[model samples]
Target chain A: MIQKEYEKNEKTVTVSVVNFNPVWGDKAANLQKIKTMVISASQEGSNIIAFPELALSGYECGDEARRDHKPCSMHEEAAETIPGSSTAEVAKLTKELGVYVLFGIPERDEKNPKVRYISVAVIGPEGILGSYRKIHLAPPPTFTEEACFKPGNDLPVFETKYGRIGVQICADFWVYPELSRILCLKGARLIINCAACMVGQTGPEFIAQITGCRGTENFIYAASASLAGKERTLSYYGRSTIAGRAFPSFKQIFAQGGDREEIVSATLSLEKGQPPFDQLSLEKERIRSFELCANELKKLAESR
Target chain B: MIQKEYEKNEKTVTVSVVNFNPVWGDKAANLQKIKTMVISASQEGSNIIAFPELALSGYECGDEARRDHKPCSMHEEAAETIPGSSTAEVAKLTKELGVYVLFGIPERDEKNPKVRYISVAVIGPEGILGSYRKIHLAPPPTFTEEACFKPGNDLPVFETKYGRIGVQICADFWVYPELSRILCLKGARLIINCAACMVGQTGPEFIAQITGCRGTENFIYAASASLAGKERTLSYYGRSTIAGRAFPSFKQIFAQGGDREEIVSATLSLEKGQPPFDQLSLEKERIRSFELCANELKKLAESR
Candidate 1:
């Protein structure tokens, strides 16, 4: 694994994600907002671009989603299946402009009749790749996700000309280490978290650090895009972030545009992965010896 | 756990540990030194006190331990069993004096016949309650722990009037989630780590922070004592530190004196435990949730 250190700089992929605070019941306004973002990301040379959860329908579709979580409702007639209308339009742009795209949409699960809510990522490389549904719904008492959404079971990691990738919808990243760790074990070094990060939080720094901490722990690169701006039922914090283990600290590449919402981009490298363990880098292996010592103590305690 | 809420002040336990920079062949000098420190901890009102690993024999016995890893040889005749001579000596002052003591010793495993280096804690309700051995060993190429030690296996927690306590020998804490988490799970609130943390050939602040970082991860109180003074082999930074999950930041209650040696003490309240995870006061929960949201992005990178 210790390949002779290369003299050249590590090659990186520049990816952009939009953190647009979508307006509830305002499909045209949100579409215009997303269009501007997609255009900016394209101009910025982002090979691939993504948006927050429910970016197309907006996160505040609370009761509206319960009525009929369909894209065709409320003027979003263009929002259809992964390969239906939305992908068709975005795919046409991909061929025209030669840029990859993944975004959020009101997903209808073909497998289960009862499951329906916000599904994300209209994957496309040349045309359309596939879809990823939001898993681990935040039920009532926490949020109303369980009532409106079916928890996605399949965790898919994407591989394009760019890099190995994994995608997840909001709140799926909480304590379910298996979701992302499985992707890492599957050799997917890049995991994208599509989040509608809520507004009015505390310790932006610590919240931001989790990306880097997990990256260091699991040995991978992770990027998260969150919804930015205030909607009706919820206000989205557009402070999206990305982290790689190589860096000492996680960098916040995207800040919710103070006023004008914009796309944020950063280059993630694959070469500088660090072994999370092997913490014993010094001359004195205290933790190792302590283990022996603790074992002795445990035996004594049990006997007593 | 919410009992700490109504209290006017927080109860903190400061377990003082003595660090030894042992002379390669000088066990008598080291034992005499420990005798003095034990007497001082009781005088200073330290509710509990500890010593570094293999404090009596000095950590640099090397091949001499191959012959006999005892405290005394020939004229001196030192090494003793768990409740043997040294334990009796240590308990004499502690039993009546109202201080709990944990010190390192060379344990003779009667069962295996193979003499392994043991880190034992001779705790006293007012004296020696029991003992613990060093479970995890620090072997070669990794560090210098393999020079004269064998590993121990087992995890144990001790119960006393002070609290249900768990003991970890230096390196053991790093490997055994079962050691730390299980202790916490099984109701051991206080975790005492005894190590003769030698001042290796590295910067002191860097090592201190590394130790602090480990303490922060496993949410429990940690009182570590390292050998102090320039005892020939290595320099003991003498900065004996004590900390817990609540106080992630390492606080040195006592440090080694410049030329001579001294004992430091702090009164710790066994009652001042953190609030239960479920009833995590509003302000605390907000920080936790905010951190949860931020770390959510990192979720997909690493797996359990």
Candidate 2:
């Protein structure tokens, strides 16, 4: 196993993105798959590894093809509570490998087990750091994401050895640019997105374009992990990627191509005042920009 | 000239993006070049045409190579007032061809001619509709945009026979995505971006990515015209492009390659409720998303 030591105050961390296909409603099988992938990524010297959305139980939501889509009630059977058995299992692996892992799961509400959220958990060497519920659910008529999961409310930025980081679910990150902006404003230097995205008319190219824009616009490092292969109702596009902000110049340093079930890794130097990021005062500029459009945006919200 | 008839109720408008080299500090020569390009674009059946930032005087800012960068004071000599001789000349052409045009210029203040703004003007057949000043200035250490021109204040959306439109100058569009979001929310079906961007490590690919995002995110058509060829201090990547928003599936209907001087046109069907654009409650969703990040965004602004 390769274990590269980080220099003092340098704050360099290796991140890995895993693209794997999960069998729908198969929690046991998916957990096993994640265990193997996490160990392998850790062995490859990755300090952090991310899995696709609903990785634990697979993306069982119905798409256009499945007319008589199974209701959210059916999928609730696969939901697990945070720090439950599945997280416990991953926690053991994180402890052994000394690596941080972020993976998606169908989360059951503590007070109401019937309520579920498409959620992602952050696991560190010590234990579960935190979790993010998927906000900005997928639009209806085509897919039934709103029918299956309850939306997340809070935007959380977790403290890590490398830097302050944030998590966003697939559609939440794809639907609009606000989630990323909020996370970055909350002091997130890097954002992790977990998705089980399907290939649409534009194909995987659309996702790739969105990923690049998210990183560039927010001036933050972004690591996105997506699923590959066919599931029950839809086929997933496997193009997990990680992009970093290049300094002195405003261009994105993106990881090349990987459109299949594979692990992609890149090292990030957590130094201050880099290009793109340093070019503008992040929070200040975002606030000003947001303020400029505050009235219009408010009107837009009311109309919706 | 090729004048394709528009179908009843179908708002299909053709847009042209021009990519050309501008002669630094030469208003007359640049104006002549624009006249030729506009006629050519009109002949090709384009109802609207867009030119690069500072196309009238070229991007004459200093880079590392240019040891003695000219002051914005020197360039102010080239600045002209709106509806001045140059815009008047373009207005005559627009009236003759029955086409709407947008192009970059160093704008002189009417009250204080000494005050200049990095601006782009929108001209219809009748006369000048309005203009947008560069709101987000380039960082001084890299480009001396701040020292040269005063920033613009208001965001104006123009109503035309084609549709509602908005304009943003180079760095303004590149810096803050809020400008595009606000314009789209304010009923701008199409946004015009005029840029005199320099070639960077990512080359034309970076600009292409940003263009796609600006269009897709707002669910609006976006056309970006950038300067091509070499200037005194920097070499520009002339990859002017016009991207259409595909309905039902948020895929960006992008126009092909642009690394030379040419007019690329695409037909936009003014159909309501298309993929992507038609998918969600745009204004409402934007309002909610903006509200979700309002406090955080405000904090960011205050921090700045």
Candidates' TM-scores?
Answer: 0.57, 0.91
Per residue, candidate 2 scores C-alpha lDDT tens digits across B239-290 of: 7877756854565646744677777778877755465434566656676776
Q: What is the per-residue lDDT of model 2 for residues A124-158, given as tens digits with 9 covering 90 to 100?
A: 98799879998777666666777777888778888
Worst 10 residues of 1 chain A by lDDT: A1-10
Model 2 off-target regions past 4 Å?
A: A1-10, A62-70, A247-249, A276-279, A298-304, B1-10, B62-71, B247-249, B299-304
- The 10-residue segment of model 1 chain B with minimum total lDDT is B248-257
Q: Which candidate is the best by TM-score?
A: 2
Per-model tally of clashing residue pairs: 42, 12
Q: How well is candidate 1 docked (DockQ)?
A: 0.08
* Residue runs of model 1 more than 4 Å from their true location after superposition: A1-10, A15-19, A25-32, A47-50, A60-84, A87-106, A117-135, A168-171, A196-202, A236-238, A247-264, A272-304, B1-304
User: How many steric clashes does model 2 contain?
Assistant: 12
Predicted candidate 1: interface RMSD? 11.3
State the lDDT at A137 in candidate 2: 72
**Cα error of candidate 1 at position A94, Å:** 5.2
